[model samples]
Target chain A: EAGVTQSPTHLIKTRGQQATLRCSPISGHTSVYWYQQALGLGLQFLLWYDEGEERNRGNFPPRFSGRQFPNYSSELNVNALELEDSALYLCASSSRLGYEQFFGPGTRLTVL
Target chain B: QQQVKQSPQSLIVQKGGISIINCAYENTAFDYFPWYQQFPGKGPALLIAIRPDVSEKKEGRFTISFNKSAKQFSLHIMDSQPGDSATYFCAARWGGTSYGKLTFGQGTILTVHP
Candidate 1:
């Protein structure tokens, strides 16, 4: 089975612009999650989507939002991106609600 | 209260040696602990995981030792190889509210010298 897959391996944007990252979960997986990994900082949970609904989100600002599709794929949208938002955005998928997550290669977003 | 603390920011282990990484969590509600290994420019892959009920779980050369009383867990890699060099992360998840959202620790970079 294929693991989680992400799009736009690298993305570059300027301050105040909007950035969208996409993730396709593995087949038969129903839960999707997003995480941000910044330099020197550990992975920070961003969002969780399951059954096409937003389940939980981290302490990030309102600008960081995302939604899951019926197929379990997810898209993370960062509005008014800031320099601090420049980081690797990783997505993961799990078969069930509380199962082990399998991660994708992640999309590296660079905000200037 | 959801923080997972990991130690030894970096480790240098000789090939054929044992590599150990430790993680301590403060949330007693967290019942699932997992370890991940990531290569440069790649996403993390699940190495092994354990539930609070089990004290230890071993798979191949990887092992997870969980101490529920102390709220700590560790990953042990026996017979380490050069290919085993990578960044390792420990994560925890609770059952109440987060819905499997994981709180990860600052990763530990392991370098196995041949």
Candidate 2:
């Protein structure tokens, strides 16, 4: 089975611009999660989508948001991106709540 | 609040030695603990995991030792190898919460010299 897959292995954006990252969950998975891995910040949870609904979120600001599609794919949208917004955005998918999450390669966003 | 705290931001060991990394959590609600290993430019992969019920779990050369009362846990990589060099993250989640909703500690970079 194919694991989680993400698009745009690397992305560069100017400050105040917008960036969109995409993720495709493994087959038959219903929950998709977004996380930011910034330098020295570890992994911070960004958003969680399950069963096509916004289930939970992390401590990130409003500028960070995402959605899950009917097919279980996900998209993370960061608007008015700041230099601090530059980081590796990781996507993970699981078959159910509390199960192991399979991660994607992640998109490295560089803001200047 | 940095609910989970990991120690020794970095570690170095010789091949054939044992490498250990420690982590502690403040929330008593955390019932599931898991460790992840990541290589440069790649996402982390689940290394080993343990539920509060078990004090320890070992798989091959990797072992997870937990101290429920202390709210602490650790990962030990036996027979360290050069290829094992990477960043290690320790994460925790509560009951019924999906593993995606994890609280991660600052990663520890492990380097094994051949």
Candidate 3:
């Protein structure tokens, strides 16, 4: 079976602009999660969506938001992007709430 | 605040030697511990995981030793190979409300020299 897949393998945007990243979960997976990995840093949880509802989010600012579709696909949107936002945004999916997560290659977002 | 703390920011191990990475968590509520391996420019992949009920779990050459009372866990790679060189991360997650969210460690870059 295919693992999680992300779109726009790489993205570029200017400060104050908006950026949207997409993710499709593996078949039979119902939970989608978003994480941000800054250069030389570990992954930071961004958001979690289960059954098309926002479950929980991390300590990130309000500008970082995302939603999951009925099909278990997810989109992470960053508004007023800052230079610090330039990082790898990863998406993961799990079959259930407490199962192991399968991650995608991630979308590298560069803010200029 | 870093809930999970990992040590030995970088490690160097000879091929066929043993490589060990240690991590300690602050939250006793965290019951699920997992280790992830990531290559350059790639997302982290789950290496192995264990629950609080078990003290150890091994898969192939990878093993996880968990200490529930100490709130610590360590990943040991036996017969390490150059192909196993990568950044390893230890993570923890608790059930109920934080069920699917994982708190990750800073990560350890391992280089296995052949």
Instruction: Compare candidates 1 and 2 on lDDT and give the better one.
Output: 1
TM-score of chain A, all candidates:
0.98, 0.97, 0.97
Would you list the C-alpha lDDT of every candidate in the order shown?
A: 0.93, 0.91, 0.92
Please state the CAPRI-style docking class of candidate 2. Answer: medium
i-RMSD values for every candidate model: 0.7, 1.9, 1.1
**Candidate number achieving the greatest lDDT relative to the actual structure:** 1
Q: How much is A54 displaced in model 3, in angstroms?
A: 0.2
Between candidates 1 and 3, the lDDT winner: 1
Best by DockQ: 1
lDDT of 3 by residue, A1-112 (tens): 8899999999999999999999999999999999999977678999999999999999899999999988889999999999999999999999876469889999999999
lDDT of 1 by residue, A48-68 (tens): 998998989998999999999
The better-scoring model by TM-score among 1 and 2 is 1
Q: Using TM-score as the measure, name the better of candidate 2 and candidate 3.
A: 3
TM-score for all models, in order of appearance: 0.98, 0.96, 0.98
> Which consecutive 10 residues in model 2 chain A have the weakest lDDT in total?
A94-103
Rate residue B65 of model 3 by lDDT: 94
Instruction: For candidate 3, write residues B1-114 as lDDT tens digits.
Output: 889999889999999999999999888778689899999989899989999999999999999999888888999999999999999999997677676798899999999999
Q: What local lDDT does model 3 show for residue B27?
A: 80
